[model samples]
Target chain A: MTIRSVAIIGLGLLGGSIGLAIREKLSEVTTTGFDADADVRGRATANGLVGAVCDTAAQAVASADLVILCVPVGAMGDAARGLAGCLKEGAIVSDVGSSKRSVVSALEEALPDAIVIPAHPVAGTERSGPDAGFATLFEGRWCILTPPKNADTDAVSALTLFWQELGATVELMDPDHHDLVLAVTSHIPHLIAYTIVGTASDLEDVTRGEVIKYSAGGFRDFTRIAASDPVMWRDVFLNNRDAVLEMLGRFTEDLTAMQRAIRDGDGDRLLEIFSRTRAIRQAILEQGQDVAKPDFGRGSKEV
Target chain B: MTIRSVAIIGLGLLGGSIGLAIREKLSEVTTTGFDADADVRGRATANGLVGAVCDTAAQAVASADLVILCVPVGAMGDAARGLAGCLKEGAIVSDVGSSKRSVVSALEEALPDAIVIPAHPVAGTERSGPDAGFATLFEGRWCILTPPKNADTDAVSALTLFWQELGATVELMDPDHHDLVLAVTSHIPHLIAYTIVGTASDLEDVTRGEVIKYSAGGFRDFTRIAASDPVMWRDVFLNNRDAVLEMLGRFTEDLTAMQRAIRDGDGDRLLEIFSRTRAIRQAILEQGQDVAKPDFGRGSKEV
Candidate 1:
């Protein structure tokens, strides 16, 4: 049940990283990659991101036992459909999309003959594209797999082992729950980051130059998250609308309460919430989910 | 107008950093510091955070040419009042609070005879207290000065030169304008971060463990900011109420527009805002306010 050859359908950050990780961690498993963009394919070849850089998605998946569609979530159907007749028999098709429910349905609809198991590696930097990735991108990170209930157990086990070898911890969850969790943990955060950056720049009294100069005052953190890939995030909101909107409703309500506290000068209420949130940060550090040093350890010479 | 002796009223992150920076950069200037908390005072003495860790505010400010209050904004008036009769006749009184207008008024009211020139060093880490201070904390960061109109020009120049000696770039801003500008750059961002972290941890459907495990996706960045000193933030919100509310209103409007776009499946609208925010990150990098490397260079061993 082991994956012998892996195919990456998009040579962007996620795809390129997967190929590089496989090379570094599972050299026995051959890798091939392709991107719709010719420029990216050229760079991937130069960087040796995969064992081979194919000219087309069909060519990439022709002999791969595991075919991972790494395109934006909105392009999942097309990416899957492109490999409709090219996948090897018994090939396990998967993706690394932020939202799971929509991706699960899209892949199933497009590749009915292929075994579909969607996964999301909850790790990344703000940068994108082939040059932005590294072999250790998934090190000590969580990768949740959402396989259809009727999927083969052997295939799921094999896929889980594959990710584990690439330095990721694997978990299985329902597609719907995965979407809800990510909406709170990832999607809503990115949405808010993007919104705040826009809000800061559009202010009339505070010039954009001022925002840029004094960004150490906590605004620069949002800028990093907002600088993430726009197309990937745009597709995430479009695909995970219900979960994102639900989480956004909760966040907006909480924010309004905080605003009221500020307007009313209720120092006690503000203190309570601000104090409680610090423990969550402690939990994150304890769980090895984040770095513990101050400013993400950015101030030190060695991170 | 040269400052020969400087006093610090609160030996916490901001205060302690000032002491250490002065010791490293301005070896000729003598520093005396005091904190209201006995344990912090003990720690300040053990860490050599100042040339002398005084037992009382009056003793700390006596004979000093510049006294900087580094307590919470809510405590500025009390800290200044403690130093009323101890300062030299021409000594300058300043503070390192987030909100400028309230701090300026509080200091002026508390020490009517002293030359009050409020300043805010737009630099800090989430970690606080005397032990958290570092000599390079203000390196390459901005220290904004807001002086009353009738203030002596020589005193203002001396204070500006002092901050420059501590490795911070200095800027002059009106007290009210500084409050409004910081509302967008610091206060509102902190408010939103505190709100989101609270929302994520309180969700009934999502376990706290799950939230912590997947935080790297985006939520962790907010947690770093949310982990800031609660008392400091509480005072910031209370003091900068109008500006924070105004900026929050604009942010809410932008968020609502984004929510509608998601609900209506308007991918173009989502992409537009997401794309525009990336440029702001670039501008911040160009301004040298932040590191140019990705993830604030967290991934690299050499940050």
Candidate 2:
């Protein structure tokens, strides 16, 4: 069975981007979407994020062969339950949530008879909402799909192809492992970003205006990550608590060690750890995961 | 003196960039430079980083009216001591170290007879070395001048005008205040970035390959910062230990709060803090401190 008609619930950055990508790359497939926010639905329609902006999730899924919930990780269960009453039989259910383990469980419980496969297309900008997405958001990105043990193999293959057609490399992994990997790669990073930004602003010695003015020194990069959709990130942490806590613990330990090294003037230890970390960034750049341009290529374009 | 001739005692990114900037903007000014590494001096000469790359610090400062030390914060004392034997009397001295308090003490102690001023151009990229310097690196950036209380006003004004000529907006700040502000804005952010990248790579459960492949989700941003010059950052943390520790303490407290919120599923707290941080990013962009483009304006355009 091929994914010919698709329904997207929650027309935010991920959902809207998927719709636009489908329209750009797989125009033969009919696309329908609905958002909880009326303003987002209006913007999605105006932007042509999908072929049709339906008034309800049920209406959106009525004639679709594939349904993808793009709501927050914590809201996945509720979003999936909203489609359970009217979803087409044998339709493949999936999501673009960061945490796959909880999302898979939510979809399975909500849509018992449906072919549910949890997937996280590891791509996005700091921006959110219907207007924030672009067709190329997933280009050269990775999409990890986690299917249940007894799920239909053909459905997983079709979904994988759909994402590939949208320009993302696809890989299959266990849902638990997906959660753990994302915790390291995505969840903990956001948490640290949010924490530092909060800390910078809360300082009594440094005025908020001064922090904003001198942010270019290094604080500004973290602000981009901290500026991500609050509700979405909030849900991600809550839904993936175990992995996040685990990663955060390790991060805190390492940070404490760094603080001690600084206090004790252990320059060698500091240099060793800093030097080791540089190799990881090099590897990330080599894999085409990030732009190799200096200062992330944001400033001082070679004159 | 009208500040006609300038000397740079360290030929790293900041030093080389100053040489190139002076050559670009103030073509009439004679600029000479020297580095501890002969290779960097050769590159500085070949790349035209300065008008003349000298073999020794004495040769670099023999005829210059102003001299700027551009070495690691920890190396400022040693680098200054290298110039003590031959530093021309009445030549106003300054440095481009991130931490001002220690650098000021080091310079004042090392060069008692020479007028010493500490200036930090709060700008850089992850890349380093002589080859990493560019003329426009200081353009639209902030250069904070931390002159001693008893310093000559004319010397301060002259240095301020020089940085302004280099295209950076100049501001006068107390060395202690500068260290505190930078601790919040630069030092702690870098420490946090280095810590998170270290934590991510040291994970026993998730393979390093997976972290590198999926870094785009946000981990990659930290890596860019983590990839910064290790020796330089180690010096920064060591020199600014008190302020860094203070800020890190605050950051850890805030991170603990966030961790608790996630563990307890306190969505309201998470959403509140996250939303507040977004406004800071907006302000930073409004102030023109950071590029407003998404993803740090990387990828799509270059690739």
Candidate 2 deviant stretches above 4 angstroms? B301-303
* Chain B fold agreement for model 1, TM-score: 0.98
Q: Residues B157-243, candidate 2, lDDT per residue (tens digit)? A: 999999999999999999999999999999888888898899888888999999999998899989989989999998888888898
Where is model 2 chain B poorest over a 10-residue stretch in terms of lDDT?
Answer: B294-303
| C-alpha lDDT (0 to 100) for residue B231 of candidate 2 | 90
Q: Which model scores highest in DockQ?
A: 2
A240-271, model 2: which lDDT tens digit per residue?
89988988888888888988888898989999
Docking class of 1: medium
Model 2: per-residue Cα lDDT at residue A226:
92
Steric clash pairs (candidate 1): none
Highest lDDT: which candidate? 1
* Tens digit per residue, CA lDDT, model 1, B39-121: 99999999999999989998998889999999999999988888878888888898999999999888888888878999999
State iRMS for model 1.
1.6
Considering the true interface contacts (CA pairs under 8 Å between chains A and B), give the fraction that model 2 also has: 0.82
Clashes of 1: 0
TM-score of the B chain in each candidate versus the native B chain = 0.98, 0.97
